[model samples]
Target: MKNMKKLIIYISFSLMAVVLFSGCKKSDFSENYYNPEKAVTADVPSLYAGLFKNETILPRYWNLYTFQVPVLGTYTQIAGYTNGSGVYEQPNNYTGDRWNDFYKNVMARYREIEKHYNALTSADDKEGYKLFLETAQVFVYDQATQIVDMWGDIPFSTAGGLNAEGKIILPGYDNGESLYNTALTELKRISDYLATVTPNNFYLSQLKSTDYVNSGDLLKWRKYTNSVLLRLAMRISYKDEAKAKSIVQGLLANPTQYPLAEDVLDKITIQPNSPTSSLAPADQKEIWNGFDVIPYPGAKMVNEIMVPTNDPRLPVYFTTNKNGVYNGVANTLTEAQVAEGATNFIFSRWDSTTFTYNHLLPGILVTPAEVNLLKAEAFERWGGGSAKDAYEKGIRLSIAFWYGINNISDRVEDKVEPPTEAAIMAYLAKPLVAYGTDNLNKIATQKWINFTIMQAQIAWSEIRRTKLPVLSFPNDPTSVAAPNPPTRLLYPSAERTLNTANYNAVKDKDNTTTKLFWDVR
Candidate 1:
């Protein structure tokens, strides 16, 4: 009887053990179970949006456009230029609020990506995020380069990098040369990565839009990247022509790469409407909240030089005021004129100006028109391709794009005589208007005109390089308080407070008048 009882106990114990093991095995393979498989993926699309289109970027751009006291704000205030030249100071100084906004806020976004990109695990899932981040980085590099050129020895690579604890801090200065080289290397890396990844393959889907270039096509991304390579190369043309030419030639040789954005699809204009956005968010109190503030001396200069002639972009770019005038304040005006509150806004319905900021303005990036004009200048200066052809194409395309009156225009048919090919050629071939020094001047002048109200920075940059579209410095006592447009901006105040050592290391090397590494002259 005892033996039989012991056998029963052993059988029961064996049955219970089998049940427990089977249950454990099933649970191990269950779908609901948590697994330590992979890390979260990062992507380009998310990174681009976060870094580039962040609210800060728009505001910085706004600051540059707004304080155009001579042109934008009716000659509101006065400031000094570098040498105290008799010419009125231009609002475009290195230490102005715009520069600080860009340096402190805009460039920081790129630094964030540089610190975090490598740590992102499941990188395969993050391709979109990565792409957008890279794109944003490119723009940051471009913006920084602009600032550095204007001021000299700027806070660059290390400007927004992390500290010992991996905490993100404000702008830290780096050598200008180092910043340029690092940015170039980063862009190259991005091009290589995008070559292998497709848009759908990325972790984020946001940046995969046809809005900027190729509708998020990875192949198109390669082209856009190559074009940017050409641009960076040209930026160093004076300092390093051989290297610049090499990059330019490489891009030109690679037909598979993007030659340039050729259509509206290729254009990167932002739609003006958003749920919460106003025509003039800066002027919340005004009735013409979204209307364009009319011509300042800046626009007047442009119109006087290019309007009612070969350039058709003027009418499309700016609408006339109610009394049938589009006037630019003379540069000699006092700050009070600029500060006047009741003046009708530039492009408002009340003023019969159809081109209000809310209604017609488009956010601009690189475009075929600008690229064509750039090539014309390059050819004219460097020698090789047909400068005249490139110039003509640039003018026509610029007008077409500006007017929304292209072959693809939903409203216009081929019925209108586009600037006749003969007329354009004749215009380019004319002695006073074309050929010799005038040719390059006309090209730059047109580019500046086309780029109004959108990417004035590009126009300013070209002026620095070519010295075309000759500017009569603002003469208003209040506008150019010191003398002339300042060469560079003062370093932001925070640098003294947060990173004194790093700031001083590069301080003597920079000033509003200090030229950058690329501005060899």
Candidate 2:
């Protein structure tokens, strides 16, 4: 959240076999584990750093254009679109890429990192290498939660055998509820464990060089872990309110032991290194601007929700139409009616410099503003702190957070100056935005607005969970893919062929209409 802090991250991936490792060279590690295929020792630090090289986490072409825009973004009505035939449905290839990204890019690598660390023989070697596995698991659990949220059950507990152990083990789908229990339990242990582990001098330097996300900052890792735990806890609250209450209250009660990332400076994003470099990230310009397929800001997002609230982040999130008025596409229209509006270019599209055209834009995962809002909801529901105070602060921080993104706008022509504190206070005091009335509704709306299309998964998840900022989509009656909005993305067709046996076990729940466990209304 530090406005002026330099953000650095990395990416070096092989096309399946062609992978990149940035942390340590073979010479750096003592001979412990070897990958005979690579003709080198398994550099634990390098593998740990490499675990974050994923398009889904890092922001890239595949997830944004194919999966996010047509699938997740539409599911929540994050934007308004014509209820054209097949608009709601996407091909298996689009969703397949997301599944591929999670299992191959995230889960498989983390398992391999564990494989290497476990292979270290000496107690001291294992101690030295364990930090890599522990820290890398934080990244894994975060992405895994997102995957489970999207598809409900996935091949989690046993999915990564091919890459990790060099065996073709078709892993069974783990229950979504079970995944949450395991993630929360392990994440709490990691949160507590991060506080005590101090790397040795050599390993510290190795980490500093390789761990570009936080530059070996253990405090940041601790905060990220606890915040993630808080998020998952709240996500499962509806199903197990008492357990969620215990987890959330414990964090709020012991801020010292469980520090939440509640400031803009503490935001967790994949930093873009360079457009050409394969170190940290790839830019998202093409997906936002060049792609004519991305939908317009919805009537609900622009007119109903934001305009009523006088939300300051409006321009930050979208662009005005040709007439210079901020209007949005309506889902109440027929396919032809929506098409006519889109043809005229009268509705607002996503903003350019702050989003579409911003080449330097980082991939957002979690933010201080988001963390605070989550805390507000937790306190409101569970009574650990002043919900009003946290809610108001979350609004303030959200305004600041958007302005921060504005400041980093790739061009000055598109930049809008941050509103004054008075403006922020006034905006917060709006009847719709103020904290007292409709507290839960207000919190859910703010989260949806701030998240926008950039964090589409979170937006969709919250919409299903809260059913706030109430919306109605013009159902595409002729479409077979999604006659109504989908509750979840269907599993990839590849799963049916590649993991045939396991896919059959969960095939009954593969339809888009089947809700995840956490999605119980």
Candidate 3:
């Protein structure tokens, strides 16, 4: 077993070297080959570059179309494409390489970054070294938590690193509960580390430039860290209400140390390298043109909810069809029915003129609207501020964000005008929109709408957590999978073959029907 594991690791490293070094110039190859030690140690910039690649979120063509768009989008009821041949018509048929993507690609890079940072000598700038480590920790928490959310038990504690160092070749799985606890501890450590740095330091300036997400703005990173902390806390609220409330109250109490994203400008976004970068999801000429992930607003999101509530940002969210009306197809449609291309059922695609389709639009990591909605829920459950204020703020921020994405053209025939303030106010005045003591449903539903195409994974996570704006199951009686939506993704086949012992231990528990640790529902 050990010999086989060593062989696998050797092959994996050789393949990785080819992938990493194939595109390098002659000069680049010489520099790396002659100065091997320097090459390993001087990799902080490359580490940051690897982290900012945006592949984990955007992914390749197969993962995007098959897994992310049709599977997750349909499950969350954000968007629905043609369910041709019932491949994505049910949860059981759904599968993804999310496990391998995180473990082999994302987490492996993070571990390498950590190893390089740790090897730094005492002569190295201590503050600079600390900044890199702390920043990496924050990202590790973000990525790892998402993995745990998707799959209940994961190889967290002993997953990444080169096998020669005695790191587990077949690491055992850790349950979600223990992983969440460790994540909270790590988040607190990062928060504490950030608290030590004073304003106008040289180390601080260097740290800022290394950050691709927030551009070294420590305040923004601090807020982002707190926001993630809040999200994790909320995730385990059902099982560990006391711990959740304590973290929430502590963060709320110390706004100076831990600020929240109060406005859309403060929201965390990853800027694209250029107009034709993969980071831009809407850049049709570049990446998006290759895939069918172009989202149509879901019917439940449009006709049943947004239309009934007279949601102010409808125009900004969806384009108008040839008839100048917003319409969405049902997810339950048969493959034959979808292929027929019925005109009345055919819905509008995303607007090309808006930032949604702009090649340069920054990839949103987390939004103020989402944080505000989370705040509203936290406040309702455990007092920190007025739930009503947070709820209203969340709605207004979401509307304002979409409005900021495009210019207001008064061409009434175009069916794409920014809603007037009066229109927004009137929409909010509706009994359903107005906040009440029992308004968790309202908050969750509005958050779902705000997520749309921007944060589909998060929308799915929230749906699993709250089950708000209850979506209907696919009505196709011929569907092969379960009647209800899947609560989690199945473990990837690699785990079954490569790490059979650990995989078998949890295989029975790993399925679409199984709820994650935090998903009490």
Candidate 4:
């Protein structure tokens, strides 16, 4: 009897344990930890794209502030690079942060736009979203080509895709020239398509409503597309002057053809503040001097031109401090400026941030000033348009834009401190003789200064091309200095590890100062 009783109890306990174990197993199995589909969404396209547009505040931080404009932000650093100053240290190597992010997020958006457009059989839906998609594509090409230009070959055809039978497609680098040609073709195709298509309310409801340009107006879209064509032609000017000239002639011939951005307002200004925008980080301030961050304009080209011409833009561009002192750093200042310079210079930390927001990035897109400058540059090179006329026009537009005539900047001087159009025009018309190579360099140099924030890349590119705005490196650490202005960015290290085949293919020609395929000289 005792043995049977014990056996019964043992059986009961065994059954209970098994039941508990099964329940626990079911609970554990219910949790979905390995979410592969979600992870795939996180995959980025290219580090290059991220530099221009991305969710990370870091993109703006790096490109807009650190890499893009930072070169102009601090004088000492440039001096260090130029003359090999002992105190300077270079930033981390260029990586494909922008590229990766673009693939991850932007590509997805493009796919969605494509899907919607393809689904629409009618002209209305087709034309509407098509323009937006095409523009996005242009931006993508601009960004991608820029990336490949810096890094050499990159995964092009196979980028942002699932391989055959759902295999992962890690592509190899395409040729730089091929990529450039492709970009040009893509821009042209889109421009052509836009010519016939007229987007109506279809664009309004297609995507994020606010992001649509011109309310899907195909005419304006066509203009923008042609404007891009002009930009591309200019980009390859160094390598293919004939092509560049032809494209310029085509663009110039059409007056109402493609409306260039009339002023700084035509450029898109991102408002990263209200309800979380993506413009630029509001917290960050442009560092000038030691307090917030050091302000720099160490490009020798700019310094020489401004000092010699007695350009008024200098005071407007840079501030000494709260005290309104105008001398550059005593050590870096020229002998004459140093003699007359203010030692007790004071700049506003507030101004650093304010100046960029208030004065610098008003419209935030290609401006008429840029078009005029480009014309001036092309005329100077090709000898058709009046170089002098283009030069004066560039200066006048730039000065006018800076003074808020274009609604770009608003300077308050207790009463009326902003520059008047007449004052700016008079300044540009100042009867001063430009002599020697130094004087000619002044034209490009002034254009360079006027291009702050909006077109640093163009300025940098021109400096590389003309070498006119004679610039020097910061007199700091020169370990990894480019002998001169670097024409392109080096490929990010990520390429080597993940996409070794592609990265290694073009590694040979990835020099910082190496010209693009079209850069014949």
**TM-score for all models, in order of appearance:** 0.71, 0.89, 0.85, 0.72
Candidate 1 — which residues are off by over 4 angstroms? 1-47, 54-97, 103-105, 111-116, 126-129, 167-171, 192-206, 209-215, 262-264, 272-300, 308-310, 321-327, 332-355, 405-437, 474-481
Write model 1 residue lDDT over 1-521, tens digit each, in one string: 01222122111110122223333443332211111111133333333444434222232233433443222222211111111234333444423445555543455435445545665677564554566666666566666666665555665654545569954444455566666666666766776666665555434345554123244555555655655665566777777788777666665555554345544445554433442432223442221332233333243443355444544444444344455554444454444554451255432121112222232233455666777777777788777678887777777677667545222222232223346567666655555456556677788777766665445555556666666667656533543344444444455554554557667777785444555567554
lDDT of 1: 0.49
Best by TM-score: 2
Candidate 2: Cα lDDT at 144: 88
Residue ranges of candidate 3 with Cα displaced over 4 Å: 1-41, 58-63, 81-95, 163-168, 199-202, 276-287, 290-294, 342-345, 406-418, 475-481
C-alpha lDDT values of all predictions: 0.49, 0.74, 0.68, 0.48
Q: Sorted on TM-score, highest at the top, how do the candidates line up?
A: 2, 3, 4, 1
Tens digit per residue, CA lDDT, model 4, 1-521? 01222122211110122222233342332121111122222111111122233432122434444444444233212211123242223243423444454454345345434544566687764555555566667656755655554445666655644546854456666777788778877877887676665455545444333342333345555555566666668778878888888877766666565455434444332333331333333443322222223343443423344445556555555544556443334234443443233233432122333254342233234455666767766667776767677677667667656544223332344111456666565566554424124445666666567766445555555555556555544333344564334556666665666567656777787666666665554
Query: 1-521, model 2: which lDDT tens digit per residue?
Result: 11111111111011122112234444422221132123355567767766665667555565677777667777777866666677777677777767776765577567768877877888877877777778888888888889888888988776655546653466788899998999999999999999888778777777776675677888888998999999999998898899999999999999899988887688877665554545423444554633346658778778887877778888787888888878877767777787778789888888776767666667787888789999989888878689888888888788887777767755678698888788788888889888898899888888888787778888888888878768777767788767787787788876786568888999999998898898777
Ranking by lDDT: 2, 3, 1, 4
Model 4, residue 155: distance off in Å is 3.1
| Quality of model 3 by C-alpha lDDT | 0.68
Query: Which model scores highest in lDDT?
Result: 2
TM-score-wise, the better of 1 and 3 is: 3
Better of 1 and 2 by lDDT: 2
Error of 1 at 193 (Å): 4.2
